[model samples]
Target: MRKTAPKKRRWSSGGLAAKQFSAKMANNEKCETKPEQSEKNEVLEELNSQKRKFDKIAEKLQSIEETVSKIAKLNDDEEKSMMKFKEQIESLEKSNLLNDRSNEKLVTRKSFVVKYVFENLEKYKFDISKEEEHFSMNWHMEMQKNNGYLGIYLFAEPIPPFNDDWSIEAKLEFKMIGKNNSSVIKTGEGIFEGLDGNGFDDFLKWEEMREDYLIDNKLTVEVNVEILKRTGFGKNNIREFDESQKEVSDVILVVQDTKFYVQKMYLALQSSYFKALFFGKFNESEKSEIELKDIEADDFQNFLELIHGESSVDDDTVTGILNLADMYDSPTAIRRCEEFLLKKSKKSTVQKLQLALRCNLEHLKNKCLSKITTISDIKSIMAANLPEMDLSTSQALLQKSLGFWDE
Candidate 1:
């Protein structure tokens, strides 16, 4: 019975179908699971690659951060250096400015010393009569106290006028004589133009100049003047006259044994005294010869030369001519004298003040008073020539010193 049953082993339909379906499901599950695993492996590999890329980017970012930090520190250091450089430049500029101010002050002081020394010396004259030109030279010495330097001021005056639109070129040679007379201590040369006054000043060390130059506390100077060139206007326009032609005298006047044969009209035009004598009601109107008194012959000659524009009036002779001009009532000559005295008053303050008071010259009096700035200056004036001052003049000076007026 068991053998027959085995041979004909029968199964239920539902049960067999169920078993097949289970096996098929199991195989399908295996296949689906294999593809899914493969896909997950691929996804995992991609994720790993992305993670490595991110790490590399992080490293690059770290390197960039370090470079930026270095740049920031360098910029800070540069800014600090710039601040220090600016401070140094400012300090240097301040130092330069101070030096400039100091130099300017030094220049001003030097100029003041030069001017003061030049104006306070007595001048010496050189006789240039042999030149036959209307040229005169005067010189003075200035001794610098601080530097022991000697300054020689050479002044040339009465430069003769040239033709119209013409100028005269003058060349001068100056020499300093040694104690032995024949030796030359120093020499200089200069050239100038025009017919006005011209001058030159030179400074030399006192130690260097005193050894062979000083003799009896005196220094001798010689100058040679030459007309280097005459420019403008033709030569034919220059008038040449003989002695007889130049002597076109219409009147003769005598002063202290000196005779001046001059044109009456010119004299009348220049002097009120001459005008009253020749043109006004005076006994000498018809006289051919006139005699004058209280005038020096040389001073009168200088006055004549001044009116004729042939000479220059200097401080040495200005006061005498001023008196003569006042006597003759010649306003032009009086004004010229006043101007000359005003220039010389810087060195002769007390004398000028007395003269101003005596002559009642208001402008000159004011100038002299203005120069007296301190008590020491007033004391100096009093010590020099206080006895010469009149009562009214002394009172005025006292009032000025007491602050009664502003100079």
Candidate 2:
């Protein structure tokens, strides 16, 4: 009875309460762990999103860098292409200039012909002796083109007897007559003295004469005879003095604040520039004094001295004198200056070469070139004072250098 009673009461209150408490504690622990896991998952998702955004930005930056690199390469290519095009254009222009120069040289090798004749043999004859004791004759001269040569032939009638000890002298003048007698194209004087009874005959190459001297295929010839007179102390003999006084200077040349008393005739005879300024149709012909600008007084004085044949040339003054001679168109002074420069060219090679190029002195230029023996000498000359040279002179020097290399 006692054992049965204990089993029936096996479910006590205290044991039941403990079992409920344990179950409740297990449920609360599960709820707390669920919230913590949810929160951790949300944080992981946010981190993944940020990583994707960073990857996308990196990809865009790489694309932009590639585009910039390609653009820079294209710009470089364009610059190279433009440089090549410009070089090609310069080459084409140089080729065109060479072609033009070649065309000009072909046109300068042309020739022309001219001729003339004279008549009336007796109209130009004169007696050589007062008593007419010496033999004399009348002659006619003719000028004509024969086989591309100018032929000057003299014709005479009743040929004079030839004498071994005596010779008949005749003076002949040839003139190129212009249209309407405007001006004499040119005049040539010749003297003929020989014992040969046959008249004198002369020939000249047509190409050798000046082109301006030939006028409308015609020329004129005049003949005169030299008279012989006895020379002794006699009543008929008289002493004569020149009695020709120099005319007063009519023009004054003021150069660099210095005044120069210049004769119009003297200047006109020495320089065509002065002749035109003083005697031509210009207004300066009426002026008594001309003020020259940009001319040095000392240089002008040296020029005057050269013209008057009262000075000697030196290295220091030769270049200045040559420049003045060229400016004034004084051929005599030019010739004199060129002669002096040519003699000094051996010692002053570079100086004379530069001067020759500046003054257009062909013979002096040739002499200067002859003095240079090697390419080193040429290079030295070109390097020295190159900036002081003019454009034409520089071009001439380049051409000369090229010629030397070609040789």
Candidate 3:
């Protein structure tokens, strides 16, 4: 059963007021005033009833306002939740794309190998390998012999221009070779960023390795690192150059053992190098495969994609693509790179000037040199790693510096 509030006695006050009024009239002998007093009491009771109704209406208005405010707050919370969900989805997509697969469009699958040689294993306490340059970064190894266990550590000595907030994922294989053609191989993977490194302290038992794997008091271990991913140095590839489109591809150009499959006439029309090799008297014209030397496969891929009307050049890859484009005499590729550098690139003025001078990009060269109005600007451009600037460019900068001092 439902329970409700007790009822209020509203009629007692009006009855008491009427009795008091009648007593005052009887004592004053004003029987004729009784009618007027009754009318006045009626009006007072009506006003009290109207006041109660007003109080009830005010309470309802307050409740309605509270309800509206709560609804508005709920709407805001739902919008915030939706925005957070969208951000999480985007972040997950980026992680999924880069985690498992190494992108071919912006890569060199094979990094260099360095061998660490140990001699007289029982005599030396600790040894290290000479640092070698791979992927434009230094790498070496450190070995420690402790308590009948050998600790092996491979490190990527982070170098300049990549020292800040940079990271690389590499698949590593370390092999310990024996004199009798037997080997103990250890394979691992690591992500090198900042001060964090990876290694195995108890890599092998020293006694057994020295007894079985020693070669006349010497041991040779090979370390191979293949970089799978890199970040914070601008390695994004906007276009794909996969050769799986085999039905349209005619030949594969191999660079440093990396293959790029493409059509002959498409490249031949864009570059004289391909034209002469594919259609001219060269032996490569008749062959289905060719080798390009002293070039990065990633750069070549971006260069080919750019010539085919793909936007693939950026600050990190513009230099390499220009190097190949200038070598192969691809006019369209050169123009596109020059245009990007002049208008869109965020490279420093000094760096852009050097690239302009080296590639003989006349339009870019003039624009960069013209931007150099002060002596300090000229000094900065000169101090950078600049190739031999042509005579005309040198004269222009010299004249600009002298003119600035005079002004």
Candidate 4:
């Protein structure tokens, strides 16, 4: 027992207690500490703020895409408008360069028909037609029997205070319509200045005309004229649109040296060209005075007058007004011109057909085609403008003309 005690004399109970306490303190030091609730809340708030910023950036990108699409559409529209304007300019330049008669004065034309009932084929008193104004001058037809023949004449009954040196180069045609729509046609060309008339003294032998053309002793005579040239009879104005109209007008339309004061809305209502000019994005839209090119002042006056419900439509002014209407794309003015040409106009059939074809007047074209009942009518229309006549029109006239071959 004494030997075992000396060999194992290494540890005491106090030392064992001290070592266990040290080990426990080291384990407590190695344990991790938890984070504060305030730090966790701050991290969550930061993540939320970053997500909101990313959402805002995405919205901005979508808005930018829409803006780019609108800009692209606008660019395409602008390019198309530029191309159309370029084509129009090229067409005008070509016309000016190639056509010497681009600015040539328009010819004045008229026609009148009369019926004379004769008791016998003998010399009778002069029968005349009511005077009609043409080329700003009065003209009439006179007929009489002389030397067993029916004589017809054309007279220029100009209004007084006339030009002392005025002269008109006229192409005249006279016809005597008979039963079955047959006639004797005579043509003449001359100059008329100061007279009421001049024509054939012996148009045809009265005996032969009575046998072939007279119906119940009635003679239907027609006269047509073309005023090719004139001098000293310059342009005249029917309505004055100067400063006198400034009180009620919104703008000034300047043509050459003439000024026309007018309201923009009134013109825009009747014309597409004026609508674009006054309201569209144009350089001249904001200007107080706009100059109209390639148009006559007198024609503008007539156009305005017709729009204002005045009787400004006549052969002397009809063609010019129509040209202006077509150029300006004015429907009211075009309809007015068409009505005048259709109803009370004294224009020749060939002349009317030519205008209908050029201006695309459907009603007038149909009316003219319906009245073409003779081979002579076909020949005249063909000779006037065969290039412009369409296939359907050519066919219709040809079919009608076949009926008159034996006549």
The per-residue C-alpha lDDT of model 2 at residue 63 equals 100
Per-residue C-alpha lDDT of model 1 across residues 1-407, encoded as one tens digit per residue: 00001111222111111000010000111112123334234333333444465567679989999986865676777868867888999777554542343343221100000011122222321111111112222222222222354443322223223344554454443445544433332323333322222332223346544575565455555444454443442212122222343379766778666567777898789876667667755567788777875445545666776666553476545655665666666677767777878875333677577556645577888888788776556655554433235544455456545552243
Model 4 sits at a Cα RMSD from the real structure of 47.8
Error of 1 at 390 (Å): 5.9
Worst 10 residues of 4 by lDDT: 18-27
Model 3 ranges with Cα > 4 A deviation: 1-239
User: Model 3 lDDT vs. the true structure?
Assistant: 0.63
Off by over 4 Å in 1: 1-247, 344-347, 383-392, 404-407
List, residue by residue over 63-131, the lDDT tens digit for candidate 3: 999986875676777868867887999777544432222231222244546676677455665666767
Show the colliding residue pairs in model 1.
none
lDDT tens string, model 4, 1-407? 00001112222111111000010000112234324445334333333444465567679989999986865676777868867888999777544431222243221222333333343433343465656555567666555665676666656655543578877766666666655545677666666765424466667677767776677666666666666555555345556678998999999999767789999999989887778778866676799999876566666788888887778888777887887777677788989899999998888777678777766799999999888775556655653433346545655664565455435
Please, what are the lDDT tens digits per residue for candidate 2 over residues 1-407? 00001112322211111000010000111122223334224333333444455567679989999986875676777869867888999777554532333343122111111122333212321111111111123344333443444444333222333333333323322333322332222222222233121112223344532242333333333322232211111111021111222245677788656577778899889987777678866667799878865545555666777887755455545655677777777888889999987764233577677667656788987777677665556555643433234444444445555565566
Score residue 241 of candidate 3 by CA lDDT.
Answer: 52
User: When superposed on Cα atoms, how far off is each prediction in RMSD?
Assistant: 53.6, 54.1, 41.6, 47.8
lDDT of each: 0.47, 0.46, 0.63, 0.62
The 10-residue segment of model 3 with minimum total lDDT is 17-26
- Taking all chains together, the TM-score of candidate 3 against the true structure is 0.45
CA shift of 331, model 4, Å: 1.3
lDDT of 4 at 395: 52
Residue 171's lDDT in candidate 1: 47
- Candidate with the greatest TM-score versus the true structure: 4
For each of the candidates, give the backbone clash count. 0, 0, 0, 2
lDDT of 3 at 20: 8
Question: What is the Cα-based lDDT of residue 196 in candidate 3?
Answer: 40
